[model samples]
Target: MADFLGSVWWMIVSLGVLVTFHEFGHFWVARRCGVKVLRFSVGFGRPLWTRRDRHGTEFVVALLPLGGYVRMLDEREGNVHPAERAHAFNNKPVWQRIAIVAAGPVANVILCLALLWAMFMVGRADYSATLGPVQGMAASANLHPGDRITDVDGRPVQSWAEASIALTLAAMDRRDARVDVLGPEGDDRHATLPLGQLPAGFAEQRVPELAGLSWGFQQRQAIVAEVSTGSPADGVLMPGDRILAVDGQSVDSADQVEPLIAALGRRGGPGMVEVQREEDRLALELTPRQDASAPGGWRVGVAMSAGTAPAYDVRAQYGPLAAVPAAIREAGRMTADTLGMMKRLVTGNASLKNVSGPVGIARAANASAKRGVDWFLYFLAALSLGLAILNFLPIPILDGGHLLYYLIELVKGSPLSDRVMIAGQYVGLALLAGLMGLAFYNDILGQLPR
Candidate 1:
């Protein structure tokens, strides 16, 4: 319940900030263009707080924090005094109207860029892909563990984060990605990993699920940070104890230990557990518990140390200007990746199981916030950029729809009929409703452990 509340709080704060900024953009631009903005709202539904400025624009904080809008005086919607007609949104020229409509999305993009720049200026810890022993299925292919990857597919890997990204992207292409590694033998060795196999739900059109499945290189260590009270590990494995191995498996790192515990279902234990505390080894017999949150019916009642694990070097800081371009490029890459994933979903190559609504977003927001301020800011920036892209999509009842109408007006030399406009709006609303419903459905389904 605490976790749920935290998620809600983070989601509200993050979304509210972004939405308010976005709406403010529209309000600012519209006012500048001599449009009479009636209401500038930070959210939907009844106003929780309201204030009227000297310009007579009613600024409001609404009940719902999901979204916001700027309402302008328009003659098409209602009766307008002859003197006020010139100040109405509809009376404005096409270019001015376009500018007003486009401002919201533009604001989101600017906010993202600013947040990213701040993030870099504040300086966050980043991993450098130094030599580490490789494990798992890829390890058997002559890629020895402890081979520091210097480059991937001709791209110089300045950091472990870059290497992880390269690995994931290379995996998507289903081709061998050349990785330059410094082997334990003190010699540089290049290994080509054939990463073609897609995960179980890779083709799922659901963005959240697909994003979750994209794994990266993680640090491996088995230090016990905390233990759940009354759980199997509590009173058995004390804090500061480094888990050595589970059963017969050689647990060299924390990563190896988790999967082993998860794999050892209820029946597999009463098993042998080995631990090292202060250079002292202790082996005890214990039965693993079942955690509903984790799959494969495996559980251990202990919190592990998080963030980037050992064996990776941390990178230095970046200047504000350098961070801006990097942030833009990153935003562009994320946008393209999102579009590609959407295409995959439409093509029936990706799963729809990953689609998430407000709930998922909130959960992710909370989780990211807990990770660090940098991560939280990064998430916000990404979401802001995504919102900008989505709002600009050619859909009715959206800014893009308004732009489309303007384009048609340019071609026909006249505005679209009110009837056509209303029809298009209804269609757009229905489409949006259906998509939201699907997203919510997916979100509910996601609550169940995979």
Candidate 2:
């Protein structure tokens, strides 16, 4: 129950900040455009706390945190005093009105940029784009483990995060991407990865495990760091023992030893293993045991220490001036990726399973908060970008919908008919309801047993 409450608290705090940032943009712009702002509210329904400023603008914190609004004095809504008529929102120039309406989403983008700037300044651990042994379809490309990926489709990538995004984009487009890698033996080579073979809607998955194109930082040496008690490795393996081979197969790296051990364990027999300890080669016989967590899989219950792991924290901090452009580029990339995802969803190229509702978001908020402040900020940046883009989608009952009506008014020199506007509102509500229903369904489905 405490954990559940903590999750709810974080979710509310995060959402509340974003919502306030969004609504403040509208309120500020509306006031600047000589419009009389009636109320600036965070959330909806009955106000939990309300106060009117000297300017007669009511500031409110409402009961529901689902959404918020900035209510401006408009002549169309009610009668305006003759003195205040000139300051009404509808009486303002169309350009000014457009600015006021567009400010909310634009504020979200700006907030995202600021958050990303702070993230880059703080720095995070980044792994080199090194391949950790090829498997499955990737082996067909003749790419070997320990190869450092330098670029994808001529675009340079310095880290695994960058490579993953670039590769995912290429896969989504069904393009055969040209990947260049520098091998361990001082040789550079290029391979064409057929990303089209990926399953449909695969890109929609966060951190999709691509079938062919896979890479990771160099693995630590297969030296035992810990031996689980009462398991297969309890008596047979000891910490600091460097595993040299299993079943006469030479193991050069840590990544190769996992499958080798699992294979031997599955055979349900004792296996001869070679290890090097203190400059002496030792032969040991040990039977592997099945791991309960991984059914049909076997394990020796040993953990490997990270060798040279500190070498991968490639932090590239930027000055205030430089961070601005970097932040813009990062925000733009995330925005484009989100737009691509929405496009795929609408076109049926992506599955509804990708949709996340409030519950999933709350869980994510809780998880990110536990990771650290930097990660929590990263989550906020991404979420802000998503909210900005989603709010701009051309649907009624959204900011984009209001902008659409305004645009039509601009082109036709008159407001849309009241009856037509009402119909659009109803249609928009229905569409939003359906989307929310689907999002909630997916969220609940994710919690059920697989």
Best by TM-score: 2
Off by over 4 Å in 1: 127-137, 150-166, 169-189, 197-251, 254-313
Candidate 1 per-residue C-alpha lDDT over 277-376 given as tens digits, one digit per residue, 9 for 90 to 100: 8979999776788877864567778777663444324643588678878777767777776787677557755556556789989988998899688878
Q: Assess the local accuracy of residue 201 in candidate 1 as a C-alpha lDDT between 0 and 100.
A: 40
Overall lDDT per candidate, in order of appearance: 0.77, 0.82
Considering summed lDDT, which 10 consecutive residues are worst modelled in model 2? 204-213
CA shift at 285, candidate 2, in angstroms?
A: 9.2
RMSD of each: 7.3, 4.5
| Per-residue lDDT value at 39 in model 2 | 93
For residues 1-450, write the lDDT of model 2, one tens digit per residue: 877887898889889989999999899899899998999999999999999999899999999897799988888899999999999998888888889988999999999999989987776456778877576556777777778888989878878878887777677677777889999998999987777777665644442256444555445678888988987778888899999999888786777777888888877799998999888999999887777664347787888767664365456468878888988888877877788888867776657687989889999999888866767888999998888888888898988898898999899998889899999999999999999999999889988998
TM-score of 1: 0.76
Stretches of candidate 2 above 4 Å error? 1-3, 199-237, 247-312
